[model samples]
Target: MTKPIRKAVFPVAGLGTRFLPATKAMPKEMLTVVDRPVIQHVVDEAKAAGIEHFIFVTGRNKGVIEDHFDNQYELEHTLADRGKTKELEALLRDLPGAGQTSFTRQQAPLGLGHAVWCAREIVGDEPFALLLPDMLHLGARPCLADMRAAYDRHGGNLVAVYEVPQDQTHQYGIVGIEPERDGAYPITAMIEKPKAGTAPSNLAISGRYILQPRIFDLLAQQERGTGGEIQLTDAMIQLSREQAFFATRFDGQIHDCGSKIGFLMANVAYALAREELAGPFRAELEAMLAKG
Candidate 1:
């Protein structure tokens, strides 16, 4: 039987150098896409996927993130005094139940692998989900929820993949897969940022993952690869040698919010996804394009 994925590790320690001035004083994960913070969206996805524990690997200036998940007593009191039941309810709705969230400091700006490794004590000896807050998935169903379903069937390490343009494969961790079987592809190779034309397949690894606990051991021993910082893909590649790795091509539009263009696109995409906002937002967008 497959061990249920009860905990999720979120690596939010990145210094969002891409966003510059805005991120200078704020963690990029706290940036808003529509009204919700990017980290909140990722947490909601994990919550929807039946994940009971949220482990955030954080950095020095990420205190705001911890506060965001906690109750604001003054704010809640003001809302109550103002008779703003709806507003109060909205805030309460998003709050995680007591003791459901945990935070650990990464301490250094190492890399994705190091951030995830920091959460090892929290995750214990179980398979867990990993979601990159920057990669926002817009779909009928949450991306990680889909991955959890796939994990139930395959019972091994699974990474969410989506097809990218062949020439653009070098920008992502590309995966080579056997033919699709029951919506899961057996991943034969995972190369982090292969050369433009040397990629084995067009399927790029999206930022969602369902990984076994053994990956922590591999990441602990992992040496720096690609960049001077340790790369999670390097450790994953090593883990694949002994365990079965599969890829699930999720159904969604992924907006890479880590980049400026991707961030702007996510705001627009998420705004258009809301029923109350979509019609007016589309009309405004059309009008702006016409003026241009």
Candidate 2:
């Protein structure tokens, strides 16, 4: 039987050098897509997927993320005093249940693998989900939830994948997969940022993952790869040799919020996703395009 994926590890330790001034003091994961922070969106996905514990691997200046998930007593009190019942309820609704969330510091800016490795103690020995906060998935269902379902069907390491333009495969961790079988593909190989025409397949590994605890062992011994940083893809590649690997092609729009264009696009996409804001937001976008 497949072990339940009860915990999720979120690597939010990256310095947002891409966002610069805005992220100078603030963690990029705290940046808002619509009204919710990036990390909150990812957490919401994990929560929807039945993940009971959230393990955030954080770095310096990420305290705001911790506070975001925790209650703000003064704010709640003000909302109550003002008779803003709806606002207060919404705030409380998002808070994780007691002891459901854990934070651990990743002292150095190593890489994705090291950040995930930092959460080994919290994740323990079970299958766990990993979601990158920067990759916002917009769809009828959360990306991680879909991955979780796939994990249930195929009990092994699974990575969410989506096709990129063949020419652009070099920009992502490309995966070679066997023919699709029941909405899942057996990942035959995973190559990190292959050269332009050297990619085995156009399917690129997205940020969502359902990994076995054994990955922690590989990450612990992982050496720096590609850009002098310990790449999670490197460890996953090594793990694939001994374990079955599969890919779930997420049926959704994934906005890469780590990039400026992607961040702006996510705000627009998420705003359009909201029923109350869609009509007006679409009109505003049309007007802006007309003016341009």
TM-scores vs. true structure, each candidate:
0.98, 0.98
lDDT of 1 by residue, 180-207 (tens): 8787899989999998789999998889
lDDT of each: 0.93, 0.91
Cα error of candidate 2 at position 166, Å: 0.6
Candidate 1 wrong stretches, greater than 4 Å: none
lDDT of 2 by residue, 1-292 (tens): 9999899989998899999999999999988988999988989888899999999998888899899999999999999999999999999999999999999999998889888899999988898999988898888988888888888888999999888999999899999999987768999889999988999999988899999999999998898876778889989998999999999988789999999999999999999999999999999999999999
Error of 1 at 86 (Å): 1.2
Residue 89 CA displacement from its true place in model 2, Å: 0.7
Query: TM-score for model 2?
Result: 0.98
TM-score of 1: 0.98
